[model samples]
Target: MDLDHEPATRAHEARLWRDDGWTAKVIKNGDDDGWAVEMTQEGEDEPALVGPWTMGRDKKNPKPLDSAAFITLVKTASEVLRRHEQQRHALLHKNVTIDSGSDRLRIDLDIIPDEYEPYAELSAHNGFGEELARVRVQPGFKLSRESAADWVANNFARPS
Candidate 1:
């Protein structure tokens, strides 16, 4: 495919391939005397998926990469990246709902995974979704029912 006047490269070598914005390469397994395959997306520095590779007919050589295998590897690598993003999202955003007198409060903790200045935002909202309080807390702050309750009981002050 041609885009921006640049044609996308498409290769199907025996142990390497580059197509559809992904590249698959066969490498020696570090843990054992076997072969492994790594799939990396274009322009990325790291491989999205890496796993064992099948042996060839001679039983001593790694199986040559083919169109079908490359396609499967791309799909698998895509899924791994998708799941990793989902897990990161879950870890960075958390919330808990607790009862405070007759009113229900929802406490949210959003972690900012900055490289140098990591921190988190702790906020509380009422049942009607009105903001009650917000403060900056440590990035590793634990958010749970008890913690949320304690924050509310402490008048929404920043937790230490």
Candidate 2:
């Protein structure tokens, strides 16, 4: 593992289930905590997610980055992505709508907690509020962002 390089901008490829995408402009390394990965969609300016990663087995305050840690990070990061997708799918209904003129799509997802009967509704509009989809997820279902991402990537990533 090498910590010599300063925390610069980097990118990493991520694949989860039916979704395959790349995370660009990831911070190389962090100072106080372990390495941090900044993730965002290609066209989206705001970051979709950002998570703190573990350092190598150096037993130091901040472990360096290495091949092994990188692999682990990928696996961990993939799981995060999967969970997000699952949560989105579970929370929302399967209704999708597309607009004609603007070429926009909108998706409505509802997440219900077991404790409460009412579910939280989240509406995500792409391009415009034209393409709309909705899904109803189990309120009791637990959401593990990391595990879900890993499962999808390992089991459902597109070949090659």
TM-score of each: 0.80, 0.30
How would you encode candidate 2's per-residue C-alpha lDDT over 1-160 as one tens digit per residue?
2357443344433322112343433353546644555555434456565666444477443344444445555466567778988977755543343343455444343455446476544333557454233333444333343322332334322212
Candidate 2 contains a number of clashing pairs equal to 26
Model 2 RMSD, rounded to 1 decimal: 17.7
Per-residue alpha-carbon lDDT of candidate 1 for residues 52-156, written as tens digits (9 for 90 to 100): 999899988999999999999999999999999999999999999999999999999999999999999999999999999999999989999999999999999
Candidate lDDT values, in order: 0.93, 0.44
Task: Please list the residue runs of candidate 1 whose C-alpha ends up more than 4 Å from where it truly belongs after superposition.
Answer: 1-8, 30-33
TM-score of 1: 0.80
Candidate 2, lDDT over the whole model: 0.44
What's the distance in Å from true for residue 116, model 1?
A: 2.1
Best by lDDT: 1
